[model samples]
Target: MGFLTDTTHMHIFTWVVGIVLFLVAASMANGTKGKKITHMILRLFYVLIIITGAALFFKHMTIDSMLYGIKFVLGILTIGFMEMVLVRGNKGKNTGLMWILFIIALLATMFIGFKLPMGFNFFA
Candidate 1:
């Protein structure tokens, strides 16, 4: 439990890997085996991100609960947009709107996350 107690580093690592994987997969041709494999690996990273993020969220739940709650929701939306963009793109459907929403949600989530008491105080 000690390793999981402070998950900020783990959470950041997961998201970084996830983003890289997303870009790799997105660049590949749709319906290809390599793309599918990369996507599956990316999905695993997504789960890791969520689990680590939840741990951090619960650990800091007492400090500015409202802001943490908002961060949590926005975090979920960010993940959702990431998945939507990939899936829709892979299906050969237009994902322009999803990409815009994904960027917005990701930026908002990161901004709030860094401003939180548990975060690195980059905003302060």
Candidate 2:
């Protein structure tokens, strides 16, 4: 139970995995054949990300909920666009727009995440 609330470790681990999976999914999207198993596993990783993210959100909420809220929304969007890119890529459809959206969402999410209180100190 305690692990569920303080999920920084789990969150970071899953976040790294999710990024790696995203790259795999993106590459597969460019192929003629589809990777059902990869997509399925990626979906599972996404759920883990969301669960840990929600836990982190509530655990670190502050007076200015706006920043956290923005991060929350962007995080969800990042997953969404990632999924979209996979789907479109499998269908051999144009995924340029989804790629752009996913990258923007990802960058924004990471920036906000690192800017949080006692968050990742890139300079450190």
Candidate 3:
């Protein structure tokens, strides 16, 4: 119960879960034998990420509200780009733009996350 209120723990938990699920969804999206279930699972993971992320955001927001807001927008864009890539890939359509967007969103998200106060320091 205490961990539920611990923003650091919550952030780590959600990050790992979201990343693992994102990888799984990406793999499934690119597979020739894909299933609708993969989309459903991805959607579930996205919802989980949002919920946990909201908790983390509300609990740990700093005086630099603009930076936090940027991180927050990047987080949502990350999810949106992910879904775009999945959709376009599943349809066997050109996904270059989607891939580019996803990569940019991911890098931005990670960069901002690491720079934020109380955020994860992968080097440490």
Question: Best by lDDT, which number?
Answer: 1
Backbone clash count, each prediction separately? 0, 0, 0
- By lDDT, the better pick of 1 and 2 is 1
Instruction: List model 3 lDDT by residue over 3-94, tens digit each.
Output: 65475666657667776766677776355554467677768878877877777777777775667778888999998988887788777898
Candidate 1's TM-score reads 0.93
The list of candidate 2 runs beyond 4 A from truth reads: 29-34
Per-model TM-score on C-alpha atoms: 0.93, 0.88, 0.80
lDDT of 2: 0.84
By lDDT rank, best first, the candidates go: 1, 2, 3
For candidate 1, write residues 34-116 as lDDT tens digits.
99999999999989888888888777788546888898899899889988988999888999999999999989999998888
Pairs that collide in candidate 3 are none
Best by TM-score: 1
lDDT of 1: 0.86
Candidate 1 vs 2: which has more TM-score = 1
Off by over 4 Å in 3: 29-34, 122-124
